[model samples]
Target: MSPSIEKNNNNNSSIARESITEQVTINEKLNLCFPLESLTQVRSDLINYSKINDKKLDQGLLSQLMIDDNLLCRYMKRRRGHIEPSVQFIIGALEWRHSLGLDKCSEETFPVELFSSGGLFILGHDNTGNTVLHIRVSHFYKIPELIGLVKQFVMFHMYKADEMGSRSFPLTGGWVLVFDCSNASLAQGDPEMLAFINSSLKNYFPAGQKYILIINLNWVLRAIKTLAFTWYPSAVKNRIKFISIKQVTDYIPLNELPDYLGGSVNCYRSIPKNCTTLETLRSNGSITLAQSAYDKIIKILTLVN
Candidate 1:
């Protein structure tokens, strides 16, 4: 063979070796994080489901789902012996989300006042190092807005959690919620809203939550809790705790919490009028993923369903 022909053959061989090495590395990582048999079973189930639904699994989508770090973390950290079901659910949910084009939904469509007025704030971490999500329940009048706000907050932390995992700290892997109801009224404590909130905390958030601290708890909230827990899952009920403002430091460090919540820190700075969209949060480093990343995650998830 001529010299150029030999050189071309060498390049092709090198590329083939690299591809095989990459595949092996991925498989090894997957095996380390999940039982290979369980992973294979879940994939087989997905393939069967697609056939029954008259849908074909795109190789590119499957590849993306397999290599996604967030999905890997979610599966690996699922409750012991539940990894298979978690994989199935994550894949199926992604497929459905993709089919509905829910990935295209933008934060601009949400009410700007949700963030501008401090309805939801990612107020750093708690004493236990769990990410603190502060929700001003009084600001929300409608259930839909409340739901949207919580989803957005969760999405923001999901990305942050992924970044933290890369750094080996995983700060957003666990959460400690502070439901500041200091100014909340009885009317705002709607049963439907409470149910929705409970469902989101239980079903949506990856890695689950550590604690849900309801500040300024009163007789009205006490009454609402009775109705809310009737429908709330028992596992999450153990994590929920009501505390007076003075008792905040007992659960969270004073330096990490907000001044309004009886902590020394004042993290809730005013949102500038121009910073009305989710992009503003991204720019401030308060949010990790861009709109495209969010859409990509939804598309990946929707492929299996």
Candidate 2:
């Protein structure tokens, strides 16, 4: 009708269009989508791990900004070794100054969620052989189920061998964390999912204690892990240090991996103090920020006493 009225109508129309765009997942433009809570947990754990190693990386103010991005799910060719991409995610998670609003951002989609939350990450691999990844959210309950559901989707779709998780590799005598790869899709649970996992474990793996969910971060963008330091007991806390993979790989005289994870391994507080790679892996469960100490724990798997 009038000039002001026409402008108002145009503004409303624009808002409506933007809302629809958010819902649509076009082929080339999908923001990093991950279950909110899971991502937070993993990120928090890694930050703790980093502190123990104490190497130090570039940190920014908006490092903890809550935003849904597909940064981790998709694979970038340039990423090599564990440390490089891990560091990249930390830096990229900082405040995006240019404000491209995700979909338009030129950077490859990154799933910072894989750090802690489980979700489907679309990693477009080259026309080579298949890659495998298996993720297990051990304390899948008490938090939320959406994290598991999303991860199931990403693993199934992208990696042929990737799965929700089943029996943590081969633990001695313990209830296995069951994984149903057959049902390779998101299955929402009311309250029953958590109940079922506990119930089933009690029946099948009653002896299983301290579940070591053997997850594969095969093509993961940022591997976030959350550990409860409170559960670590003081005896385990003081001996944290970085050891080399070469150090422990050869020390095995056990019948079968000494329970799949060695007990002699140590967890360090910082990466800077790493004398070898083994120590780096053991203590790197959390490493985004080198903070004092939070609710995270590094359960280093060692061979012998």
Question: Which candidate tops TM-score?
Answer: 1
Candidate 1: segments with Cα more than 4 A from true spot:
1-33, 40-65, 76-79, 82-84, 95-102, 105-111, 143-172, 267-305
lDDT of 2 by residue, 10-49 (tens): 9999999986665454412533333333345545554665
Q: Which ten residues in a row have the lowest lDDT in candidate 2?
A: 296-305
Quote each prediction's TM-score: 0.62, 0.19
What's the lDDT of the predicted structure labeled candidate 1?
0.58
Displacement of the residue 124 alpha carbon in candidate 1, Å:
1.0
Tens-digit lDDT track of model 1 for 1-305: 99999999999999999987776787576544545555566556655666665343333445544655444445436544365666565555455444433344344433344445566667667666666777776754543323444454435544344334334343225666678888777856767656655664454444646678888867777788787778756777788888888888887788887777766776474443443454464566544666676465335324311
Against the true structure, whose lDDT is highest?
1
